[model samples]
Target: MPRRASGPRLYLDKKRRQWAIRDGANFIRTGCPEAKLEWAEKLLAKYIAAKYSPPKSASPPIADILLFYLKDRVPMMKSRSAKYNVANLEKFWGDKLLSDVTPANCRAYARTRSQSAARADLEKLQSAINHWHSERATLPAIPKVWKPPRNEPRDRWLTVSEAARLVKASKRAEHLKRFVLLGLYTGSRAGVLRTLEWSWIDLEAGTMRRRAPGASEVANKRTPPIRLPRKLKHFLRRWKVADGGQCKYVVHYNGQPILRDPWRSWKEACKAAGLVGVHPHVLRHTRATWMVQRGVPPWQAAGYLGMTVRVLEATYGHHSPDWQAEAADI
Candidate 1:
């Protein structure tokens, strides 16, 4: 008996413990039984057809490409901020083809939305298109998207006295005091804190495990635990003792977790503290600013705040007392 020549080679992959089909340089692994040569051939045919198939058009629908990109990229996104980008981009340009997305189209989108929103959407689109092109080795000429001027990072920060005032004022609102304190001390986002469970916190160890809800701890690279400040730890101790230490969440109202927006209570606390335009996120800014002002290293501050060193430098570098101080000596 002689071996028959086939379109592509087929063999058993010992490492994968599966039958594999080789299409030129590409290998497709399948769980088909080794004796099932007919199934392997069918799979190889499908794989080769899909792999070598020409694009339906020179430029497919932008929406189609965007969908593909989102399918691949969304899972890797560790923050909820990407949702805004996805929504905005799809809303404006989902129907258009890649070739039809012109500078004017981008400008029109920008005009309809704010420049910041346009910038975010276009940047996401650009990234998606770039990835698609890289995968297919087809680089189509694309219009340049205009980006809005980057605004100066907000410098609003609360002094220790101001923070104390806000925390004290928030005591009137159930759970707001602890929320404010945790925000100011940990620099964790409101969403993270709101869905936080008792299991993640370690009072004796003086640490709290932090990660975006529904995100995989092992898969997500961005969200990580933040150390509890001594003040926050002490506050938590007292809070736990008072609450009988049985509640599932750290911030609760009348034995229930505070899951929804706490805007009313936040506003009241801000007003009482005489702070203007302050929000939950400002507590994060305040914490980062305070850390930099107190001479904490940029890397350490970034780690504590669950951001990168580049972001730390770009946003809060100016607040660091040591930053650019040597220029005066020169």
Candidate 2:
């Protein structure tokens, strides 16, 4: 018998009168033995003359790969957004195979997420999809199906007096104090800030690095060192003295690790300062806005804040003094 040129032969189980061997991806054998037998006889004759096909390796099933991610990867991720991502995926693609996840399917998922019952959840799904595609090396091409809803404009920056008051009121709250100071000085994201360690800080050099969640211990993927403001040097020097010899983290409360969620403490800090609606993450925005207002370009401000230029411009630029000043001057 000669070799087949393509896929494996679709065999007809003539004795049982059924078709066998269906590859889920690209090849499907008809269940009717009558159809397969008629085709098989033609194929056997062609094989005798040397023109038949052989089977190829099928890629791993998408559903199995997704299950692996949910079971192993999502649980290991440190970001707060992981749970919501898992939920959105379960809503739309819990059972779909990886090969079956087409661009259209992704697009449809995106569309459904846009009109999601909750707006916050809509963005959550977007990030989840991005995370999913970024995680699985083998996946159908991701499709852009929907644009996120416009977020309301918010000016969450603390006034200078408010920051001073918040800091003073937070004196009794050690971690919040350190977190606020770091937020004011480093302009790093809340996610990266929560995970920063003393090991990543070069005290003498007055610099700290940003590390995203889920990056390998050995791989500081996407995290790069950022130089601290010269103005903050004196404050850190004093902080270091009080921190005692050395610790695994630069920030702590009574020598204990801090919670990743700063909302409760942040709200408390805001209320103590007689301000309302302030979020811990807003301190980051405040610093970045102040920098750009002080003549720093969006690109430089973005790098300082661990954000992209586009994000820096879009989200914080409106609050920039320079932007407002320029508009007034124009």
Candidate 3:
């Protein structure tokens, strides 16, 4: 038996070193050079839309709607995971029509992904549909994109002793040490730390700006400026002199920015400290836990940690000695 023929898809023309759309025996050139893959993808989306998208009043193929959203909306997103979420969603929903988004199908999608991950992916789907609807003057009633229940916030945080051991173990690697210290003291997410530059640190003002200039400000993943801890300030000052003001990024290897997470060195540090299953984000959790244990006010701690007060209280408030003191007295 012969294999079935595939439909229009992206193909690299190795001879010309450019992207093209393969449609049966013919190739439609994208006019996009090798370096401009995103542009090629956008052009391909236009091709798919022109060919497969239904009339304005009818429900459209899931792929066409998603591709339209990808072309129009995703470019403005601040989240790094947006493209991956869209790709995963496309895999399951590509051939399906918008009318097929039923509760049963949504649950099937959930079963294939982790609880939290499924929720996130479905949320993206929901957003894409909403975006599509908003742009259209008329269409069928939007199908609901069901999602799994939200998972409880993770409870894993390090003890003071464990944090100390991890930091000490990290001392073997200069970049890892700085990464750990900044994570523990400032409670910034790993992404912020990865992109942190020396220019964001203000030793004289005793503050550190977590967000890069001109980066889109995301409400959920806030990156508010925080005052530097006295100890952390001293470390930064010393590191500045040691680096001789040559490095651009704070968490750099040989004065060059790390293109990816320092997972190998981080895992080694964790192993040397006799810790397991403790990823980098745990350091931020540990800092929040410590502050709550010390009876820090939720608003103040939330501000310093670049999270909302409601989130801080919901996740770590129980650690406070005075938590529910008045209510529990009964």
Candidate 4:
């Protein structure tokens, strides 16, 4: 086996007085030290060319971007998954003007949420704030808010027995049963389930695709799918829909679209299940962790769950510590 390249690279075609770029993937595949170093040097030169290039409109007020995000950018979004971002952003940054929306302010907002008693929830908020901040702009020279250097991902994993109980409890909530089971089995975000249209599910292939936010409601967008568990497939088969897949969910309430925050139901379920403070996201965390605990690869878990590995580490990694630590044992 050969060593992998550390990063991307650029090559100087001095003979032609030009530069050529090679990527991390290429150098990684080559797996030679010289190739890796060559790639790194090229990457450095490319970085010099790309650095300090200001946006056409420098310093657009935070208020403007946020307003654009909310009134237009957010509402127009078709994915139910993205609504969570809107809601989270509203919870944190809704009241402030864009000029007041410094990276520091975002960090402070995350910090405040992190200060909550839910050891796991605090980190969840920090991670989410960071996600919202990661869009297009270059990071600020100094963040007004700073994330403390600590790895305190909350423990949201459910024991198999606990999962069984939650699955049993879900039966009592007619509208939410399938949704809860989907969370337990698939570990997808609640928002995605809430806004999922029948159009998104590829029944034959057994995949649930995601349509990223900001695309047209009728636009041709592609969201990768997850393989449907057999139980989930049965649930979908028995599931009824209106003439078109226009209904709001895989489950419903009062024959109208069910619209309730999942947290409320999760809380009630925890109480009934003889548990406490079991956040809805915790259910998601638990499901993903179950995969890792069972020796599933993080990359597989991440792709199935639609999160990055960096994210899996910071958010769901708490449960995998023992598994990860055993590399020493190996």
Candidate 5:
């Protein structure tokens, strides 16, 4: 006696002039005509075989896992920083298998990149691998990666006189003065300020928003409204009225967006100002330090500066007037 077919039943749809496989109530169209019933039958057989095949026991390669994470997880993230880290990770370990990312491999990567960068890459990789393992249950044990010691936060701050000199020297770079002033007063990151637009500024409310409308709120990176200082508000009011109110970006050079790094201009201004090793980020450090020294509560300052109170205290606490007060009391 002939054995019955175990796969889906194959039939031709007269109306559509196509062959289809019927599995229970579902009919999957094969797009083949009735003349190709043999082809449709073979395709159906393969599909049945695949559906019944046992699950693979081996863990996916690191490259495959990273691809999955980027496709499925990265899109859901509100923070662009994760995407940036993933890009760097892909560049470093695009071809490596998950099992190959041992501690030695991590150390090798650290040799090529900075300690902090290497740590971030490894953490991302670990998270991706763990996620894959959770879904597939293939890996017996996740690979261990070495972590570098955290570096102390930078302690560079600018004095009021130095800041004034820098601004005075930035006279040649049309927007550099305003940019410096904003950084000094607001304590916002250079990237955030560089991308800031006039639309996010509410002069009437005496505040400036870091992000634009409809932009994703970056994780742990709040775009809190920065209350304008009296000096900054006065400068911005005059600057806005002077331009005939027609520019889009808050920081522009000759009406063009200062999209690229203004390193050369900044260096020249620093030289003229007699300031050494001054960078745009140092302005953020300076502002935070000044806030602490001037007795601004850590919580209030952190909110205004778009950082956590822990980070504020960790980095700028030494500048706080209350720093080490308990120790002195003892």
Candidate 6:
């Protein structure tokens, strides 16, 4: 019998000093330097995904569907959570086939992970299968990925004193102080603040836009421009002057951009402040609750927070002094 055919594989072309895909007799240059093995592997994976045309009635391995989406979609997501979620999903479901995505298996997966995390992971898994089905015309059908019940929206928010203590405790890390202040004042999500740059801030105009100029908007993650509060405006001016030309991101550490979530430092601040169950996201809730308690109109607050009035009323309305007032009076 003739030797069995081999699939395309990564090969370092020593003479060219670049990575290439070896498909039997042909060599496809990957344009990645020999030192960047990760990039070369990703390129190989993309090439494999592009060539994959599953036959109808075939059940594809869950890993292939995930790798396809990981290569194509996750990079475009607004938050890094998708990448992490996909990674966890891959570890659990990579060995399983699409046909294995049964309710029982999903429940088993959830049992091993936290409710919120498992739900998020399964959501990504569902998206990956959907994405795969959309792209592969030869695939018969997509399998359903069961997800756990979503956790209730957290009701935690900082009191004025707690907010003060957090701010004071954050004094140990200037970047963290700026992070807490920006979160409380602007009501922007922690991800938004991590990606915020000096160019988005207009000290002269007294406004700051969450979205960058000319950037495409991600679905459901709107970042409308926020009018700068006077106190926040003052702090921005001082921070801008202090940052000089050294840093680009508004919330950076030691003149370098924060490439990852600063949760460790945030937790440390919470610990020092004598607070528990507090995280960066609570700052957004705190700001919204404060506005509701102070009698800010829901419409105004919603616009300021880049959310819909309905959402504002649904999530934070209970904090409003007038909430259910007529019902209570009866």
Candidate number achieving the greatest TM-score relative to the actual structure = 3
Q: TM-score for every candidate vs. truth?
A: 0.71, 0.60, 0.84, 0.54, 0.75, 0.83
Q: Write the per-residue lDDT of candidate 4 for residues 1-330, one digit (tens) a residue.
A: 988865555555545444455555542222224435665565566454443232322344443334334443445555454445445555665555434645566556666554432223323333433433555343343123344555556775788888888877777776667777877887876666666666677778887765533543332332346888888888787675332455655656655655665666666777778777677776678888887777677888887887777787677665664746777677
What is candidate 4's CA lDDT for residue 268? Answer: 73
lDDT of 6 at 175: 90
**How displaced is residue 14 in candidate 6, in Å?**
12
Which rank order by lDDT, best down to worst?
Answer: 3, 6, 5, 1, 2, 4
Cα lDDT, all candidates: 0.77, 0.62, 0.88, 0.59, 0.80, 0.87
Model 3: per-residue lDDT, tens digit, 1-330?
A: 977879788899888999999988888999788889999999988887667643454587888778777867888887768788888999999999888999999999999999999999999999888888887424568888889999988889998889899999999999999999999999999988988998888999999999777766788888999999999999998999999978898989888887777899999999999999988899899999999999888899999998889899999989899999999999
| Pick by lDDT: 4 or 6, better one | 6
Q: Model 6 over residues 211-238: C-alpha lDDT tens digits? A: 7898877657678888999999989988
lDDT of 2 at 321: 66
On the 0 to 100 scale, the lDDT of residue 192 in model 3 is 89
List candidate 1 stretches off by more than 4 Å: 1-57, 69-84, 131-144, 212-221
Per-residue CA lDDT of candidate 5, range 1-330, in tens?
976655577878999989988876687998888788788878888767545522434556666677667766778886566777777878778887767787788888878878888778778888877767776556887777676777667787889999889989988887887788889989988877788888888888988888877777766777787788888889888888867778878788777888765788899999999999877898889899998999998899999998999988888888988889999999
Write down the worst ten-residue block by lDDT for model 6.
49-58
Model 4: per-residue Cα lDDT at residue 227 = 89
Please give the range of 10 consecutive residues that has the lowest summed lDDT in model 1: 49-58
True lDDT of residue 123, candidate 1: 83
Relative to the true structure, candidate 3 reaches a TM of 0.84
Worst-scoring 10-residue span by lDDT in model 3: 49-58
Q: CA shift at 111, candidate 1, in angstroms?
A: 1.7
User: Where does model 2 exceed 4 Å of error?
Assistant: 1-80, 88-154, 211-222, 320-330
Better of 5 and 6 by TM-score: 6
For model 3, the superposed segments whose C-alpha errors exceed 4 Å read 1-57
- lDDT score, residue 106, model 4? 51
